[model samples]
Target: MKLLLFVSLLAAAYAHGDCGGDCLKACRSCTCDLPNDGPSTDDGESPFQIGNKYSGDCKQLICKDHNASLIVDGKIYDRLVCFQGAWHFGYPEFLEEASSAMCLNPGNRTCPDDAEMRYEDDFKCMCKPDFEDMSDVFPDAPEDILPLCTNCGKKKLRITFLIDNSGSMASVIHEIKHFIGQLVKFLKVSETGNNIAVVSSAFSYDVLINWGEQSHDESAIHDAVDSIDADGQSYLATGLEAVKAALVQPTDENTQHKLVVFTDGSIKCGPEALKSLARAANNLEHLKVETFVVATNSRYTTRLHAIANGVEDNVFSISSEEDDEMENLKVAAKLQRRICA
Candidate 1:
């Protein structure tokens, strides 16, 4: 019995040591310095196809896409990384071959070719960009995690203006109106398939596709927005959910659904409601939803961060306590990109 207990504890220790955590679900960054140029297979039986990483603007940290060495804590290690479906990092195929190994340092210090194991040398690590799935509802992500794209990919964008229409929003409604127009104009000409729509609800906003598929009518959306007079309590969640439901979803060959919620009032929803909203948004593909929260409440910033994820830049606070609501409107107008053509 004593022997069995000892063995059991040993096994448990080994198992605990292997804990990799949850990052293995979709992607994982390798810390080992092994050199192998291969594509990372999805967590499936078939292996991922191997491909070259240096294509166009795509880059691996350092001059090379893969195969870089670094000295960390007096130990040499190689690294591999997977970003955007490409395996940019991996093991090197050969050992040191030069008569003198080059130090990554500016001096390019030379060491014996056989000294791959001799000196404590420092080398640079290769870095590659990370690829993230877009959201259908407002997204919440860290600033550095946002993917870089010179041109919009196959993303379908539908930004809805959800202005707080309760008594608290009356001062900001006109500004919200101008903000919508500016957003619409910026998106219409992008050829990025960026679509614009509007909706209003008591204490929050809703989708105005009142006329069905053709709901993108300019005057109709604007008039419908104007029709909503400020009144009622701030039922922020209801309107957000309503807008989420209204987002177009024929993800067959074209179109993507990205929701942008604009609000200037406090939220009345609790934690559970917020989680449900996040879960609903997380399950959609081809959608990268985000919120551009505009308000004066610093206390509510945390809540906004929770809802928006790492999209903190999306949050804008109007600092002037004495400025008229029109000034806020001007701010909103400029918040939306302006395009003359």
Candidate 2:
């Protein structure tokens, strides 16, 4: 009788062990037979009464029938089973959460192909180096979410400014300067990949700021603009020729080239000079030239419009006689919108 009792006790112990110590109250036939009465702790040894809870890696789990239950928003729904000593979700609806919860730190978080996980005040996915941030254009986007990123290679632009520095432009030089300053601010020239070059059109064409020369420095570009002064005659054709030469230089295939001309409707040479200007402007292979005629008289408007390929949208006229300050601001704002588009 003593030997039989010892063997029975040994069998009970083996059954309890096979149940992974989850059957604290009762282990019947090598299984937990009691509901809401199992080990609540992660170690699987202590008994958990009804309504007891256990904290898992991603979520808090409640004990029910020796299995962990998933509770979301104060309601317990699905059961979580123990696999390899860790609680795993049993339902497909929670799979995404399970995968995301594996990342305990930013370094472990997975990001999209164009982005990478980073930590600032908190863990976030940010755009990679070769990508550009397009946040400003999306004003209605959520504040907490990061903006979408775009490829830098596709959005590159190269802009050249050809300003007429003839003696007739003395009255509007300051306005031109203000316009240039506002444009620089709007373009975020110092922070972006776009390039700005300034060519002065007078008795001769002078390249004040060459392509990629101090291109990223806003203060330097402004200083160059400030140095410009009204002098000599407007050699418009020569200026166009210079701009054509500059645009012909090899650039990235994806780059969009633009020429912005600020003239006071004065050309030194006669009809032949106009023809020369037209030829020079027409021969530009991949350039979009915009003409801004700033003058008090409408004498040169027709000629300048012709030079702009008769596109009224391409030619902007600003009258120096009416509200100089307001007109410059309004025209500058318009140019900003067009260029940024």
Q: TM-score per candidate, in order?
A: 0.43, 0.52
For candidate 1, what is the lDDT?
0.43
Clashes of each: 20, 0
> Model 2, range 1-341, lDDT digits (tens) per residue?
64564465455444444332334333343222222322245455433231234311212233333433333222233443222223334443232122211111233445545566654445566767866655564444344434345453333467778888999999988877877875665555643576778889889988888766576578878988999999898887788788777654555556677677887777766788788877776765335444443343457876677556566676776666535655554555455445545
Candidate 1, which ten residues in sequence have the lowest lDDT sum? 94-103
**Clashing residue pairs for model 2:** none
List model 1 lDDT by residue over 23-66, tens digit each: 23312321212232222223422222121242321112231223
lDDT of each: 0.43, 0.57
lDDT of 1 at 144: 29
Candidate number with greatest lDDT: 2
The 10 consecutive residues of candidate 2 with the worst lDDT sum are 96-105
Model 1 ranges off by over 4 Å:
1-156, 189-193, 203-206, 210-216, 248-253, 269-287, 318-341
Error of 1 at 226 (Å): 1.8
